[model samples]
Target: MKKQQGLSVIAILLVLALVGAGLMLVFKIVPVYTEYGDVKNALTALSAETNVGEQTLRQEFDGKANVSGVTSVKGENLMVVAGAGSNYLRAKYQREVPLFGNVSLLFHFDTQAGQPPAQ
Candidate 1:
């Protein structure tokens, strides 16, 4: 019997299917993470601002989130915690992405920004 030198049709199909699934996942998940990064940077900038109040922070965050297309968490959802000598801004949210049929992927993000200069 002669040995087959290349991949069979079944093997090629299976490999292609896996690659397609992986690419699909990347396409679906990359946007969410990109938005998360935007939100994080916005929060960090807000934290760094001096003399900015909660209301101002919320307004800024809302604008930034809108521009960044971050729908997972809104400015109203941000938690402003006051510590002994500093304050912190926290955002916690989740994103659900539909994959194949009823299958879905869930991503949870929790990010915090502390006062730029903690005294």
Candidate 2:
């Protein structure tokens, strides 16, 4: 009998299963990261806005989050720090995406923006 030169049926099925799982993970994860990017941008924009107080900044951030569909961090949870006559904004949050059944992926994001004091 001629020797087999290609993958067996079982081997092919296993490879296909792995590839499918990888694609599924990618599909589930990319959107979460995209949302994180939007959150970062929102924080940075709020930091740069002139003449906005802490409460106003929190409100604006909430508005931005609503518009961007970011559900991880609410305006009430944002950390506002006062330093050297300036305000700083920090956002620390986490997102969870289900992979399969009870399995899930957790992602944490921390972002901060503000001016630094002179050296």
Quote the lDDT for 53 in model 1.
Answer: 71
Question: lDDT for model 2, on a 0 to 1 scale?
Answer: 0.83
> How do the residues 1-119 of candidate 2 rate in per-residue lDDT, one tens digit apiece?
99879999999999999999899988998899898888889887877777667788899889999999988899889887545445678888888888777999999888888863346
TM-score of 1: 0.86
Span of ten consecutive residues with least summed lDDT in model 1:
79-88
After superposition, which runs of candidate 1 have C-alpha atoms over 4 Å from their true positions?
Answer: 81-87, 115-119
Instruction: Please provide, for model 1 over 1-119, each residue's C-alpha lDDT reduced to its tens digit, 9 standing for 90 to 100.
Output: 99769998999999999999899989999998998999899888777666667777888899998988888998899987544444578898998988878999999999989853345
Per-residue lDDT for 60 in model 2?
A: 89
* Local distance difference test, each candidate: 0.84, 0.83
